[model samples]
Target: MADTDDVINTGDLFQDPDGFYEPEKEPTFAEHRMRSGDTVRGDLLWNAGRTSAHYIEERAAELIQGKDVLEIGAAAGVPSVVSAIKGARVTVMTDYPDPDLVDNMRFNAGLSAAMIPANSTLHVDGYKWGNSVEPLLAYLPPNSAGFDVLIMADVVYSHREHPNLIKTMQQTLKKTREAVALVIFTPYEPWLLPKTEKFFPLAEENGFQVTKMFEKLMDAVLFENDQGDEKLRRTVFGYEIRWAEDQLK
Candidate 1:
């Protein structure tokens, strides 16, 4: 909704009655799959790669113990839910205009909020990354506890929104600035790497540092194309970024 080509209103899945999303019937890739029989495919319901949240959740559990957490661009919110499951004090899953992820996330809240019992919070809001700070800020009510950590995956799909992505984090993140704030990116292509580097100056301009926070390349395997070709590999890059703690103040 923030006018980005990479943006998809995954909330459309809710326009229909059933929660089931029938992603395009194509083979999934090995890296994106949790089980051998499964693959990352898109449907009217969920978007690409279902298992990345598990990794993000696992990683967050290590770094974010007893800290409030936020995952921007959380398509399905499984990672956020898993963070809650991991006993985080607070965790928020945010995305663009599409509330479909939040809709299902609400169900997750109902199912396990009592068991986890951490200060778990979830929301659906539009974040245009470096576009504007107001949109992302509007989601956090006044006197909110803010976030101690942030998480992301597969968000660097487009080279255009990189600036907004960096700026948005620099603006919206309340905690974990400077050497603490972190953003992770999944690999897209050889071209995407250089485009991401151009934002380093932008990060410095905002009084933050854009380090290669984290990188985890999963197994590569052939998957189907729209035309049913199996020549492509599951191309994804898992990454992270750290910000200075002073930026929030």
Candidate 2:
């Protein structure tokens, strides 16, 4: 594993390159019978308030209850925290190790501590995609097969980290045929929707199967002022990924 210090700062400079300076603020989202607030700093606000997040929040009982979840590039960890609140056996929320990003995730987790189910637990950590999974898997409960679900929201916007994201999914997701990864994203740059979507093919090549779950036209324009395909900015794509039958461990 690369030293955490040596890991490139992809979580900021690359993962969410479009994010820019904004005055410090606290943003909140309500979903899954839960509400969470985040301390916003330098990181892009990709937490559960977004349309993709709404999808997860709406399906919490079906997807999160009694499961183990791991969320990658979780800017404010809304889905992870919400999953824990909805009764996930365990929810690990991770982002880049940058003090600010990690600290903000912790703050958001704290915001919902009172709502976490008695049978569930929530943990926060800084994780660079494609890094060793041992550290993350270590958080699994004793005798757990692996994470029952993996959540990747908005992180797929970065064209360069596709493989790293897939690699992390392979290493951390449970091998059971039923285990799945929820990939939800919007092509903020409408013109680059094709490139942003290539991540699915790459995942198929790496022993996973991707199924289109839904496409939602969000009420809010993700990049209202950005110059891109307007239709793409307002649409959110959702997918369910699982190990191919032949690749199941």
Candidate 3:
């Protein structure tokens, strides 16, 4: 036998490799207080969604009141809740068909039920972009053309889904001049902003006209230590998409 100092040392034989095992992480949430003073919680409460909610509250008479409204990727469903409160005839809030996400949206909707106008309705559902929109359309009044306004907050970040998003818009947006889709997002990963902006030109190519609405700077960045320009990360960009006159004909 060799001396103790010359003995080879072997680590735990049953130990897994460094990256071979990762424990499931607990879900995290972002909490926000709506204008009504009620707090809402979600896996994400993106600033872009808050900006869109403010815009809807500000322009309810023209954009939401008495209109059919749909919010895609409605993580927290704040804008949809506000629309119902503002008197939208029908407000449908949807997100990825994960049980937790859908349940969260429904919970938020239920929390604000008292604030919603008695004559108006707010519904929540799970949806995937580019999928059949028949279920969504069925929520509208019988013989209805389509939704009058579509709220899409913080969704363009998924560059790969741009076409699918536009496809959903084409299927759900009313053909009338008043129909519009609101697209809002922040460059969380500032370096990839160009990719996010590409959604507009793609929308135009899909027979829609794009209009820049506003750029808002929040008090603080969403990801404090995230890379790239903090200003860009803190800024929320807004746009409106509508069927081109030629396309509407």
TM-score of 3: 0.86
Best by lDDT: 3
For model 1, how does the per-residue alpha-carbon lDDT over 1-249 read when each residue is reduced to its tens digit?
Answer: 133323322333213334322342332222233232322222111222344455544465565556666677765555565566566666666666555645644554454455454355545454545455564455555665456667665565444555556555655566444224444443333333555455455455555655653344446432222322112224344334555445546
Expressed as tens digits, the lDDT of each residue in 1-249 for candidate 2 is 222224323343234344432332343343333324532122345432354455666677877888899999888787777677778888999998999989888987887798776899999999999888888988998887689999888788767787678778877889888899989887766676776788888788777899999887767764446666776677778899998988754
Comparing 1 with 3 on lDDT, the higher-scoring candidate is: 3
Which of candidates 2 and 3 is the stronger one according to TM-score?
3
Off by over 4 Å in 1: 1-62, 99-115, 126-145, 175-179, 222-239, 244-249
Give Cα-based local distance difference scores for all models.
Answer: 0.49, 0.74, 0.83
Q: Among these predicted structures, which one has the highest TM-score? A: 3
Ranking by lDDT: 3, 2, 1
TM-score, cand. 1: 0.60
Ten residues in a row with the worst lDDT in model 2? 1-10
Better of 1 and 2 by TM-score: 2
Instruction: Give each model a TM-score.
Output: 0.60, 0.81, 0.86
Q: Which candidate, 2 or 3, would have the higher lDDT against the true structure? A: 3
Residue-level lDDT tens digits of model 3 in 162-227: 767888888899998989999998888778787678788877766789999899999998766677
